[model samples]
Target: MLRIHFSSGDLARTRIAEEPDPLWETVLSLQQLREKSREPVLDGWRRRRCARGGRALRTLSPLMPSRGYFPDFLTPAEGSGGLESGIDAVLSTPRRQLCGELELLADHNPLPSEVRRLAEGETGALRRLGRALRDYHASVLEPGWRDIASRIEGDRRHRTETQCRLGTEEMLRSFAPLMGWQSPVLCADYPVERDVHLQGRGLLLVPSYFCRRTPVALLDETLWPVLVYPARPLCSDTPAAPSARLAPLLGHTRAAVLQALQTPRTTSELARCTGVSVSSASEHATVLRRAGLVASTRQRHHVRHTLTQLGDHLLTGVQLGRIPPPSASRHHGRA
Candidate 1:
């Protein structure tokens, strides 16, 4: 059920092996402190449960301190046995070299210009750029501390989006050949209203790089091999059975626009909603309108949007009978 398809470098591997994981130590210490603090409250049943769970619970992985260093989703749940085994496997795999390279990049302390220039045109280059941004903000940008808190929030958002895009693209490119997939491809479907039998058939090709913890595979029936050739190839395979769980969002401008309009607001309102310039909103709005979720009416020089019947129906289906009457239609898939 688990297959790792990425490589890591030597230096990152060494760092992983030698790194003094302070955060892991802190976690264990905190847990011990809590245990001592709660000793008086532990009854016989509670003590039994804690003792059982604590036997396997060993340590935590240190929080990734560098921007380029993402948690390995292939890694199993952390504990004494699993953590040690995972680390051993990672060190032995081709991924060791890739991990080493990641750590080296994290520790290199490159000049901004050099980092930017080197990473330019490389696959997942935006992630490398993000690392530079993080380092710059931490070392250089932090000194100009005007409205520091808000600035951090804004920077974080920009950093996350860029990093995700970069990572997703990189993953697709790397695995594309192995899976016969393509790069910069758009895999889309009409977001259908949910129906009976708890079935939905929309397929999403998530970038394995962005997959946290473990890769989630939804295609196991009919399309067993799921051949994805380069240059946006189409599958003649019939769609698989659907679970009630929501499908993953496609990483496109249309999805972003629809997401912005979840509040039953107008097109102009969404422009203000995202603080993006008005022109960008219009461009994105056109795509969403074509998707059949949002409809616009001209009001003087501006256009306002309300959910179409299909949109409203989709909202109900997505909510699965749990929507409150007042805000039900208004709350599309915003979050």
Candidate 2:
């Protein structure tokens, strides 16, 4: 069990990440790949990645064991831009901290001499490690990035909606079955029992598509506290059949608008994809937004639309042919 103690201020400041942290995804995904775990979702990804076979895997495998720690410098703090920026942060770590962390890792798991040198602040080795990280991302993560991003975005939207409707306490409570929440304490079902006191630094909740089993947090409590939990599974256990009832209600143009939001898109891009005028696309988006199926936000000059969790659920129901007709009233035979 991993217990995270919180204070009133901590509760007030706790928040969820708005977007996926690329570094966290990379490290966690690599861990998943190494373990060769039989997670259904990762089956295809693992097969494809193994087929490619490269030097990046060779370099990374030794440092990241199938289990145990992999050094915190690899992931950096949240808001460190994207993958490249995060890698930059890793490469730029001060020699003393790097040496200490690497020594600690070596105590538990053997490290390649080159990796040890890099940890000791060797400039050449740092560059090599940087290349390895980039190559790993290119070969492993870039291809399926769209699907990954969409799933993460959907998760964030769901959590945001939960927080708004049920309050922060309820939202925290909902992290259960994975982590039990009891007022000032949240307990995670970790392999090892541990305790983490927030000390009023608060906590950042990061939803990860690749994270499996127990939620993960940094071992060094002095750094910023974060809890990376598995995102809600996007794929159903059984494939969903198409919905017959949703199409006519939304009509063709509006339906097109809703479908185009599977990934975020600007009004113009939505119009282009649907073969409708921008004004028509905007109007359709407005209607969908009003119906709580889509959300539109202005990014500079362009308005981008993304499906809310309700929208995704509605679409899933439609795909499974499970959504009832809007006119189908529950009280029809009753009061």
Which candidate achieves the best TM-score against the true structure? 2
TM-score of 1: 0.23
Model 2, range 1-335, lDDT digits (tens) per residue? Answer: 57888899898788888878888877788788768765544566566765343677787777766677878887788334788778889888889879888888889887888987887799998998888888877777777777677778877887778888887777775554355466667765577878899988889999887888778998888889989899875543324222223558776456655765776888766664455567987998898899898988999999999999888877766353444544645545422
- Give the count of colliding residue pairs in each prediction: 13, 4
**lDDT scores of the candidates, listed in order:** 0.34, 0.75
Predicted structure 2: lDDT: 0.75
Taking the tens digit of each residue's C-alpha lDDT, what string does model 1 give over 111-155? Answer: 344323332323343333334323322332233323222322333
lDDT of 2 at 31: 84
